[model samples]
Target: MNYFSHNPLNRFSEIRPDTAKMGELWRHEQARVLVVSNNLSLLQAEAREAAFLQQQEAVALANQAEVRVYLGSEGEVPYFALGFAGLPPALLPEAYELHDLRQVALQLPQEQSALLAYARGMVHWNLRHLYCPDCGSLTYSTAAGHVRQCSSEACNKHHFPRTDTAIIVLISEGDACLLGRQKVWQPGMYAVIAGFLEPGETLEQAVAREAEEETGVSLQSIAYHSSQPWPFPSSIMVGFQAVAVNRELQVNYDEMEDARWFTREQIVAGLQNGTLRMPPQFSISFRLIRDWFNQTGAYKLEELVSA
Candidate 1:
């Protein structure tokens, strides 16, 4: 599974509407809160793990939070997420730090990373939707922070959490796959072609569009691979493997720094010599490349990269 895919918490959707039940869960002995501020997650500074606060410690903080969400529960233990408008309540400065979730995701345990991703998404949504778009009125959190309702009685519109959907595809032709790097990315880092899905377009169509726009490669056959929850302000990255119709390249300088077709042998040589750097292992991009690289069983992508 991708890093943030397998969330074990049972998000009790039915119970979200039960305010009394949610309050009870919030006060439960095992209830814990994950605090988020400006999209950064709270972490134990030395341990490099998620900093989950006990109920007593969180109660005062929760009262000042702009948004509080009932994340879900594990058996009897309930999990909640709190989003602060400004700086979150301070823990011991040396003991806790606010870190970008992306930077610390790999260091944390898988389940903790997934749980924090979930919290981040909810907090982001609630914070952004503090006002109703339609009614131009202030909104209030409801449905355990899964929804927002306009305060205006005349335009009481309900808003739900939303995630932007994007397609990331590895365009392959025989022994080679297409990869590209953006100028803002780290030096020597390259990954698959990806872009947001346009309104009214199918996922396959989005894949085809992104490939042509970014790398000028037309796809022959596109197949669904998998998906990963990218909660950097809430987005779901849908993965795909597509066959290139041709090897022709016309890099869009506006969208990409460079695009190229790389054979398996070239990838191995690049990794061995420190010239090529693949995406992080936790990402679907790495999975796409790994699966394609190991198709023949002659070379192990993971071993080559690690070594």
Candidate 2:
């Protein structure tokens, strides 16, 4: 069974790799476009589904777009994303609302939510990569927006979309699991320890390092659980669960405001009494916590629903 992992778009990598092939998809009459402007995605205010625009409306905006990516097809209909950086909010139509991807994910259907995340990530990449990093030269998008080619005659290179890998692990010792809260987060809200994976490090190594650095606890028995596409800009969250060697609370104040182990009973009481809140059901964090509770028989599925 699917457990709230939001990715749904069937990205046709083979077709998108050919620039000539993507040109035909763009001209197809049945093409559907997702318009993103000023870090917000466009959607119908009433129905809240992705308000796909036809070629006519899309072409009009495409004329002024910073970049456009071919996001593959759903059956016979083609899909594309048009990005407009710095577009004014006042220019948006009254019938359509410019909502952030986070809000759109919660409001839109599974497919639409996945599509919006793709659009947001591609647009952000395009905006930040107008110049080549290899050589100080201008770059142009190629391969149907899948790659960027350097314009410099002396130094030519290709750049592709980037997704940073991060590890989010729940550390457990016996019946209790460790959770940390950042100072900026709401009071009593805690989640798993997470950090970006450094070069030459495996997922398990990253998990161990992050756990010790943030919570000062060594972890063993590292096991992979699942992963989620977190498209705030672009990130892939690799989820894992591990057993802590010790249950000491030595939090790095610079990394997190507070850290502590919460027993299953305490966690349940926190939720029941409104003293703590887990990550929303839409995120992998929630699943990691819930999975632990279920596996340990800390709380029944029905108890979580009522709490």
Would you estimate the TM-scores of all the predictions?
A: 0.96, 0.92
Q: What TM-score does candidate 2 get on C-alpha atoms?
A: 0.92
lDDT of 1 at 138: 96
Candidate 2 overall lDDT versus native: 0.81
Q: After superposition, how far is residue 26 of candidate 2 from its true place, in Å?
A: 1.5
Clashing pairs in 1: none
lDDT of 2 by residue, 1-307 (tens): 1122555556788777776778888989999888888678888885478878887677767877888988878888888988888765544545776787674465668767777878888888888899999997999988778888899988889999899999998889998989889998878888888999999999999999999899899976899989988768778899999999989777899999988999889888888888887765667777788788888664663366455
lDDT digits (tens) for residues 106-199 of candidate 1 = 7889999999999999998998888899979999989999999999999999999999999999999988999999898888888989999999
C-alpha lDDT (0 to 100) for residue 44 of candidate 2 = 87
Question: How many residue pairs clash (N, CA or C atoms closer than 3 angstroms) in each of the candidate models, in the order given?
Answer: 0, 0
* Residue 84 in model 1: lDDT: 73
